[model samples]
Target: MQGEWTGELVGPDVWVSCRELIPAGSVFAFLAEHRAALSPAETFADMYPSRNGRPSMPPQVMAAAVIL
Candidate 1:
């Protein structure tokens, strides 16, 4: 089933969960910061269907997942 990307606040414990794995100088850190600033739900509202099935992942999340 398609799942919506609910931009819920990730808990503090999970913040930096991947910090050790990603290099400090990588572009991922920059993208992560920009991702937080964007409102993906509102930005891709029109692209989702209203009924009959589950919603698709938010566009921003999908983009980041693929690129980062």
Candidate 2:
């Protein structure tokens, strides 16, 4: 994958894609799993754009933000 790729850890050798987790609805379960791994203020920071007027959110967050 050259661009943004979403996947879940099913096993040491398996990275189940988000589509595999929930084949129907647009549920962002993967973010929920890694939210805790993110540092303090990271969640809010992820929600909002950059203060310097630069593009807000990381590439991954930007992609997911569209769903929200």
Candidate 3:
């Protein structure tokens, strides 16, 4: 099962607030700004066939980690 970013919008935006901490125009910065737009759902849904077990890391996080 893949974990979704549930109920995150209601809380503090730690990622957005830390933009200055990441180097501008770098992969980290790019991902921090556009991870959701880059990592689409259809692109990775096939990897987790069953949505029953413990959820896996969010696709965007995995994508950013891979790029880094």
Among the numbered candidates, top lDDT falls to 3
lDDT of 3 by residue, 1-68 (tens): 97775545565665778767888989777776786778866688888899698988778666865865
By lDDT: ranked, best first: 3, 1, 2
lDDT values, one for every candidate: 0.62, 0.42, 0.74
Task: Estimate the lDDT of model 1.
Answer: 0.62
lDDT of each residue in 31-63, candidate 1, tens digit only:
676764654556666666565576565677676
Per TM-score, the best of the predicted structures is 3
TM-score comparison, 2 vs 3, better candidate: 3
- Candidates in order, TM-scores: namely 0.53, 0.20, 0.58
Candidate 3 regions off by >4 Å? 7-15, 21-23
Q: Which pairs clash (backbone N, Cα, C closer than 3 Å) in model 3? A: none
Q: State which candidate, 1 or 2, has the greater TM-score.
A: 1
Off by over 4 Å in 2: 1-27, 41-68
10 residues in a row with least lDDT, candidate 1:
6-15
Q: To one decimal, what is the Cα RMSD in angstroms of model 1 from the true structure?
A: 4.1
